[model samples]
Target: MGLIVQKYGGTSVADAQRIQAVAHRIAQRYQQGDQLVVVVSAMGNTTDRLIQLAYQVSPEPEARELDLLLSTGEVVSCTLLAMALRAIGVPAVALTGAQAGIGTDARYGRARILRVDPSRILSHLREGKVAVVAGFQGITEEMDITTLGRGGSDTTAVALAAALKAQRCEIYTDVEGIYTADPRVVPEARKLERISYEEMLELASQGARVMHNRAVELGWVYKVPIYVASSFTEAPGTLICLQEGESMEQRNKVVGIAHDTDVGRITIRGVPDRPGIAAAIFTPLAEAGISVDTIVQNASVERLTDLTFTVAKADLRKAVEMVRHVAQEIGAKEVLWDDVMAKVSIVGSGMQSVPGYAATMFRALYQAGINIELITTSEIRITCLIDASRVEEAVRALHRAFQLEEG
Candidate 1:
């Protein structure tokens, strides 16, 4: 008589057969005496396709109307999934985010969760029915519908798990789990049995698209145990939880190497090393909603310094324009921008207070003849920007440097 929240991404229930298969899985779990709450995303590529259709119709889509159009993708998924469950003799009902009382702020596109009243969901649960709720979309305090940001469904699932006090939140995805290096980057990379929420957050922020940062942040805040497994393969996947003293925490000194290909670098060369220059340079990019990561300011001269910051490649053009304004405002000699940079990070909590770890990473990359454009370090991670084409090579070198080859 416990509650469990399971969220399946679009790929999991993309087709009719997959929906029926998911229904069977949920029914088996439901009949086993658990009050099951399911959160589902839109069908596979549905959201993307919708965006394409919208763009074809109109070049620039308004945010409010776009949310209204985008929110329908999840509705189709939830209802169909519910129907599949019912056909198999399972008492299941699909509810939109609003119908289930998932309330959020009126932020239009990327609204944050305000609260969730599970009265309707609980009613279905008490009546021996599985409550299936659409993920990502929510209702505002003013009773208007809003869509959560990208990967919002994962956030929705984690939020619901926390609200329901479910035993665990399972996030089924396309990959088996987090790996020592992206399997595509390093074919010999090994899957992690476990990773701390902190490391997971850093990884997600760095580049792991399997779990969203907002969802991981919620999980950390709520102390919710999260599992990421494959939807197609019945592989034993990864668990993300506390730092250590857990059954799955690894004994290795290094955890994983994360590489991102969609990162660009902007170097503000020869700026006067004034106190407010860094802030002045980054403020515009921040205001544009462009996330800046791994900033480095070259050692100052008598009064001159070069500062660099990382932003997503997709925002390269806008960020460049912002930097141009910042340069003119701050009196920088030159504004250098490169969209061909990739970021590679080595993340593990053990690295804190562990000497020479960063040195070892640098040596490995050096041995591979991969040029490092910029280096950034934290208490628990080391990140570097290199040529985009060498991203995979950098990851492989780091993975081997850490000896993460699978047995």
Candidate 2:
């Protein structure tokens, strides 16, 4: 058997018992004669607790310092996992991101992986040892520690799989697999047996929590297969792949519903409708490393228009401050923002060729009496920004409208 790369989320190895269980699972693969490389996240809520502690000490902790503090969470988990495996008579060694030769650009909390020099990891595997790695944290050229924002562990696992040419990358989490809708939000939502990289990417971007979009992109680019399953169960899970075959039925079906509540909207009112105006308003935001989503610009009336867009709710304060400066720089009337809105979206690859997908989605929301504040669309995704309070209702309605329940 070839090498296999496996990643366990925080919940899978939340404590000593769970760590021991995961170690046994890895031992099974090793005993079967397969080389294994394992990636582990922090224990449950450890990262959150560290962030809370940082804030308790400082009003605004420095990004570089925060990265240094948060990286310890994964290191602790990795070392403990290695210890667990060794105690059970399996050869194992834990390595930090730097120790594994995972190099990334210097972006602090949301750094991007520039390259992965897997010589150290390969060496460990060649020694017939399970190489345990600390995920989500990497070293930059400046030798500063950086965290890969949210869901970085998943990225690490896939990147290693691609670099090592592993047989497969398995992501073990709390859930069985990706579903049409969040199981908590829609009781009728069904787990998918397989999903395409394109569809998974759309759902991940729109707010599916099972996998991160960045990780999916890495898998797609490397043409690596990813399997998602629950660490505690033996049941077969979903496989995210290039395609499920060329079937017309699969081409035009609504695959999933994704929603995001951690969003904030901003509107720049009374801005001049000029060629460079849009770029001028958004350039500063990009420079500040703020990601903008779902942008809408009203048609000019009397040579003025309003530009509205969305950002992560956590960045609302910083975004507002930056936009306010741009508003004045462009001589706009004023800048207004709202953090009480959430985005709900339905994604399917078949949407591009299928008419009425948008209409059906709109009709479902209309029947539910949910007012849509903003709307955006891609070939396979239709997203509506609605009052945050109505998101659950909207998701339920859409899930029912699409008939996503298992037969």
Per-residue accuracy of model 2 over 173-257 as CA lDDT, tens digit each: 9999999999999987899999989999999998899999999999999989999999989988899998856788767889999
* Window of ten residues with lowest summed lDDT in model 1: 244-253
Q: Using alpha carbons, what is the TM-score of model 2? A: 0.98
For model 2, what is the alpha-carbon lDDT of residue 215?
97
| Model 1 lDDT, residue 292, Cα | 86
Task: Go through the candidates in order and give the C-alpha RMSD of each one to the true structure.
Answer: 2.1, 1.1
lDDT of each: 0.86, 0.94
- Where does candidate 2 clash, by residue pair? none
Task: Give the lDDT of residue 127 in candidate 1.
Answer: 91
